[model samples]
Target: MAKQVAENIQTVLRRLQEGDLLPVYLLTGEENYYIDVLSDFFENKVVDEVSRSFDQTVLYGRDVNMDSVVGMAKRYPVLGPRQLVLVKEAQDIRDWEPLMSYLDKPAPTTVLVFCYRHKKMDKRTRLFQQLKKTGEVFDYQRIYESQLPQWITDYVESSGYTILPGCALLLAESLGNNLSLIANELSKIFAVLGEKGAVTASVVERVTGISKEYNVFELQTAIGRRDVVKCNRIVNYFAANPKSNPIQMVLPTLYSYLVRLMIYIQLPDKSDAATALGVNPFFIKEYANAAGNFTLGKLASCIGYLNEADLRSKGIRNAGTVTDGEILKELVFKIIH
Candidate 1:
């Protein structure tokens, strides 16, 4: 499923290169990566620079209504081969009658692109069905957290760089599911590596300024092993550097770790643990040991402690002015005991 979705975007790029242009493109999706790619292609590539000033009409959904959008699309290009009308953040558009009517017979000289980010267009609407018949309509699905490592690997290779599976997993676990930020961070790494070089874990750490040893993953490991000293060391670092290690972010990682640990405890089969947990096989033994230290009931209690910490961090049910570091310290104490 991931392969097919990835390929679909590639096919669109391939088609664009071949000059097989669609009259209108509806790029609405949960993942803004592909939507941004397609929108950028049209903005910078589809319209030549010389005529772009005259032919390209960029409008935001908040500023313009369907009437204005249809008005701009229906106009003939003065200088360019085609008029490119791009509507960014098109999810703000509510009324679609004027655009729907125009799509009934869209202008041949116009290429309309809609970048509707982080949302799905209602397929039940007449406008959606009409656009499907008359133009390109793509709904990019959100890539899950478990699928990020492979996605990172594919993205790196596509950009003429090589990364090991473990390094990719590290990136995936650290960055979570923010594809835009991940892409930006990867760009920084690639820029430093020059035309082509192997992306090592050390290179990633140094280039991205991510202190792997002091990160939330290490904290999770310490907590899992019931290493009170190690856990406190990391927690103290996190508390001092609240800007980087915000409690909101730290809480989520700890919560996810405990939940995964709990799931690991319930799994009857241990051979396929890595596959089940979407993690590297090398870490399975570590998790196993941690799982031994933390029973299902203990894990549940830890999660509850984490929830309480989150509420306190947000000033909900917090009896006094509790510092983030103090809240974290209390939570860790509860989990460890």
Candidate 2:
């Protein structure tokens, strides 16, 4: 399923570049990054600059209805071979019946694109089913946390620059799974580094202002090695900068790391552990060592601590006036002890 979604995006882009344009595109998904990219491509790439003035139409779903959209799509181009009709925020369109009917026999001379964001069309619905058969549906789901590092590397390489694995890991750990933000930050770094130099941890820190030594990645390493001093130091640093390192982000990342460690402890064959954990082979050694340091029982207890910390961060059942730093400090002590 994952492989197919990734390939679908590439295939769509390739088709667009090669001029094998689809008449109708249903771009709906939880992730808006790909939807924006592909929809922008159709808006800019489909019509030539000179012809777009007459042949291109951009509408907002909140401002227009299905009948009006269909009426415009049925019209012929003024001075070009085809016309481009793009609808942004298509999820706001209340009536899908008319659009589905139009999609059944779409105009051959028009390229219609629906940029539906933040949600997907129901497969069980007649609209989705018919569109699946007639037009192209690019369902852009959010990439998993495990797939993020590779995505960062691929995004960097595609931009005509190289990034080290450690640099990618730092970006992933600091930025979490927000691809849009990551892409923006990488663009800033690329602007400085240009296409020739490699993006290192220093470059990431210099450009993005994320510290290399004091981050979730290093905190995990410190906990895995049972280095109480280092753990406290990183926790203190995070506590000092609550906005940058919120207890909300810290707890989930620590919980995920421990959960993966617990899974590693159970696997009989450790050879394919990296694949199982959805982590890079380069960081598998850290997980292996952490698994050795902490037993399944300890990991389970650590998860419980994480849950408590999460609740405290949300002010649920958290008595008195405890700062986020205090919560993290206490959570790290519990985990390491």
Candidate 3:
């Protein structure tokens, strides 16, 4: 009954596959990969398509209060030996005291799964405490940019596909936080490659339509080196392939990098500061060298440029139609100049 934190999505699935059918399950996170996987797992294990009737129910926590959830959970299973109850988007619920009370003595024949999306329950909440003590809890935090390669490799391997390390990072950057979309993309790529095939950087490039030669990372590198020609070329490349190399994609990563640099600037120019920022030590070494090239004022200006670019990308600013190349060129000029 000790609190178990499922740091990895696969770890939670392994537990479920091992038949760790707890009476109550509380899954909450921004990552939908874990939520969707668990929901599907419960749907298959708890209710068969032919047998699903009164005993199986899927409810949204937003529309239904704790009383409604408790009421359904308390109900006896019909002709079926067990009841399957799933509460999706549980973050929408206002109050959960009633639900917590019911967890004290959950119905023996009921499997209640509460899938909280985009947020987590307050640890101080009684039900959360109870879940930590008795129920299964899975927390799927987003994988960091650096760790994404290994994560993708493992994910693809688990799904009966082999991906080269270089292609893994390429996929991670291309797909970003959209795991479902990434999976779908990979599925398509795999189908095109056929069985017993390995995914190389070039093969991934050919199938996914994201070139390894010119990507956001390279663009950032170009900007960092103040190579105007390379920067303009990358921007043009993105403009030519806006679907795969969207403008919105670069802002988040650029903003994140600048924010980290600002944070690093405050700390002593030492390796520990980079380590504390959770960046790669090599990047830290780079930053240690690069930090001197720009002032706090310049970094702040870069952030402003990213912010303006982000707004323009979202169509919030720069109302007139403008090419992605122009926007990116302006952005690069703002930071570099």
Candidate 4:
């Protein structure tokens, strides 16, 4: 499903570039990245700059109804081969039934685009089926977190930059699977690199201010090694900059790490540990090395501590006010002790 959504981007872009356009482009999806990409093209590239002033119309869903949208889309271009009626936030337009009539016989000389972002149109509805007959419909779901690293790597290379091997994974770790946020961060990296250069951890750290020594992954490593000093150092970094490393993000990561460690310990064979853990094989050694530090019982205890810390962070049954730093410090002490 994700792959199909990705393929929709280039196909639609190619059609636009070649001046082969459909009447209605229904870009509805959970992932707004591709929707915005196509929407931007329509707004900037579809009509010539001179013609756009006369022919192109941009509408927000909140400001217009489906009748208004259909009315604009029905207009013929005054100065170009095609007119553009772009509707941003089409998801917010509740009068969808009014546009169904327009979809049956849309204006041939107008490219009507709906950026129905962050929500999908009901595929079972007649409106969706009618859209397929009248124009292109792209429903892009968000990509998985596991797929983000390769996506980042591909995006950088496509933009004429080289990204180091684990650097993509590191970026994925720090940024999660939010493509827009990742893209924004990559832009910062690109600005520093000029035309093109290799993206390394140092470069990422330098541009994004997400330290190589003080992210959630590093905190996991510190905890795995039972290095109390290193663990506290990382935690302090997170505490000082809580926005970058929120307690919500930290608790889940630690809990997942401990769960994976417990799973690694019980695996009879070590060769398939990476597959089992849903992690890259190169980092399996971290789990292997940490196996000696945590028995099954200890792993359980650490997870319990993580759960307790999570509750405390939420202010559930807590005796007094405790800072995120204090809760994390207390959790680490319990884990490594």
The predicted structure with the larger TM-score, 2 or 4, is 2
Question: lDDT at 171 for candidate 3?
Answer: 80
TM of each candidate vs. truth: 0.88, 0.92, 0.72, 0.91
lDDT score for residue 224 of model 3? 66
Q: Please tell me which model should have the higher lDDT, number 2 or number 4.
A: 2
* Predicted structure 3, TM vs. truth: 0.72
1-337: candidate 3 lDDT, tens digit per residue: 0012223566666777776677888887777876888899898877666667778989997789989998998888886778888998888889888876788898988888899888667778667889877677776666556566566677677767787654675687777767778778878878887775787877777877777778886676666677788888888888788877777787776677677777887886564874677644546655565566678999998998888887887677777688766898789878877
lDDT of 1 at 290: 91
| Tens digits of per-residue lDDT for model 1, 232-276 | 999999888888778887898788778888888999988899888
Error of 4 at 265 (Å): 2.9
Alpha carbon lDDT at 284, candidate 3: 68
* Highest TM-score against the true fold, candidate: 2
Between candidates 1 and 4, the one scoring higher on lDDT is 1
Residue pairs with backbone atoms closer than 3 Å in model 1 (clashes): none
Summarize candidate 4's per-residue lDDT along 144-200 as a digit string, tens digits.
Answer: 776676688778886789986468877888887788899899999999999989998
Sort all candidates by lDDT, best to worst: 2, 1, 4, 3
- lDDT score, candidate 3: 0.76
Off by over 4 Å in 3: 1-7, 220-233, 241-244, 251-324, 330-337
Task: Score each candidate by Cα lDDT.
Answer: 0.86, 0.87, 0.76, 0.84
Which stretches in model 4 have alpha-carbon errors above 4 Å?
1-12, 268-272
- When sorted by TM-score, best at the front, the candidate numbers are 2, 4, 1, 3
